[model samples]
Target: MTIRTFIKTTGSVALGLFVATLVVRGEESAGKAIAVRHSSTDDTATIQVAGLEKPLVVLHITDSHVTVADELEAQYQQYSSRMDKSYGGEKEHWRTKKKALPAAHFLNLLTLAKDRNVDLIALTGDIVNNPSQSSVRFIGKALNDTGIRRLYISGNHDWHYEGMPGSDDALRKTWTQERLLSLYPGRNPLCYAVQIGGINFVAIDNSTYQVTGEQLVFYEKETARGLPTVLLLHIPIYTPANTSASASSCCGNPVWGWETDHGFAIERRERWPKSGNLKSTTDFVDRVGKTGNLIAVLAGHTHKARTEKLSDSAVQYIAQAACNGGSRLVTFAPLMRDKN
Candidate 1:
């Protein structure tokens, strides 16, 4: 899990190579090359994984936060406008310096993904500001027109309606099934897996900041396939060394347990229970560290980019938000050997 991180400036773009030893539990030595390129409008990363039959290229996009309310949802116009304006900040659109809208940033990412010939589009979460009909329909059509395979899961903002009446779990389930289900694959949107280029790309909805028992079982069954797996999640799982300054906002912050939320979630009117995380949530985190074939975890939510070593076997990579015109191109390739 050791890595040497360095950034190189190439004209207007900054290139980063995260070099690491890709060691799997009960496996021989393997090294992975991760090259990340950052520019004003978009960010891209290339990851090379061993034991693949062929190279698989994927475009990872997250947190676009597009806000579109149509005639059908006139009541939500104010909310949408507020959310949309929030993205006009420098951090949200570094490429255009707030000159472009959030919707524009999303369109740019889609165009870039197509131009790159990406095999799959991995959207971890927050594709929309809420489950509004207009935003959902707009995004769905755009994705369908691409005709490319995709994996999508929910984010906290994707389902929350701000003043909606109902618990977080209830609203998430209701809106996800009623409005967002079509955007996901198969019958279940909570957790699902698809194979691409001999690799298992799994997407799970931990947008609630907690994992359910059902999700844990789904994960177990998928990993049982024993294929090289990449997990897509909205929230990054807690690491043992979770004492970073971002503890207040990150998952698995020791203080994040039920009783000590510190009223951080009060403003949303829906706080995670004071009772803390369930056994299922903690169990899921434990299993992730032990899975032998697991290669990497792709996640978002902090609206920034981060990389953490999940274990000696896997690394968790959080890509920058698409609202800022960010993207990461991940390639899974067969292990190359030198011949004398």
Candidate 2:
């Protein structure tokens, strides 16, 4: 079956209006970052984190789906061309209101981030259509030029070499090491944590729609540190409210068990294990719900804007695809104590 592309224009962007305002209650931790209030305009969302000493501005970007190949990696040119056309490489930009290619849509976001003096750019996943050497290098160079701090993880497409001969696990490891490791530097490409503005940002690669035992343990240890935390992953964790018919229902789709993806595997020329999600994957999801210090979960696989209330205090924010000229500005500022 041929995959079809559809662009869903969000009311926030299309109507050029400010959406709802959410009051986030602060946690009891004395010095931890706490969400106080949230407000958003067309392309920006400002979140107030209480007990913060200073404001931290972060730009959330996802699913840029950059498609390009250098001469040496001509083997992937066909795949690149296919994805470029799928995303409408020459479509008009939503933010800039100008015609741009998929790559330009990504670059334009970086320019906006820099112009806004964004402290960090949190890229959830699918930044590249494929982990081609040239495509990865292009993203790295462009980001470095902006001198903005960034954290990235792979989406399914990021490490997949369509029609490649290998198990999904082996392919991911091989291509990630060969083409995408530089972006990670000394950190573990599968899972790692960083502290920016005293808030812990833990990133995990859940592109496979499953989590490994080691990653689960890593997540447990990281969030146990008791600081305000934000969890980032390529696929959004399962939520009952996500009733979309698209394959975007990821992480732990109830029916996504063994043999459920025969059509998907064949369509993408990739492997799906006969055994569905491991017990560890479900445990990870349960752990996410119970983690007290976790403030927000940010993800991007669906390429559509969404927010799911995970718990009374925690909300998951999903960004639209960057290829569709979508980006979100999230500002964390100290809460005004007297307001509450």
Model 2 TM-score is 0.85
Worst 10 residues of 1 by lDDT: 33-42
The lDDT, on a scale of 0 to 1, for candidate 1 is 0.72
Alpha-carbon shift of residue 107 in model 1 (angstroms): 0.7
* lDDT tens readout by residue for model 1, 246-304: 54555555556556555434335377677777788887887787666667788888777
Please list the residue runs of candidate 1 whose C-alpha ends up more than 4 Å from where it truly belongs after superposition.
1-42, 77-85, 88-92, 95-98, 258-267, 338-340
Question: Can you give the TM-score per candidate against the true fold?
Answer: 0.82, 0.85
lDDT of each: 0.72, 0.74
Candidate 2 lDDT over residue span 5-55, tens digit each = 121123342211111123233641212223444445545665555567899
How much lDDT does candidate 2 score?
0.74
Model 1 CA lDDT for position 278: 76
Top candidate on lDDT is 2
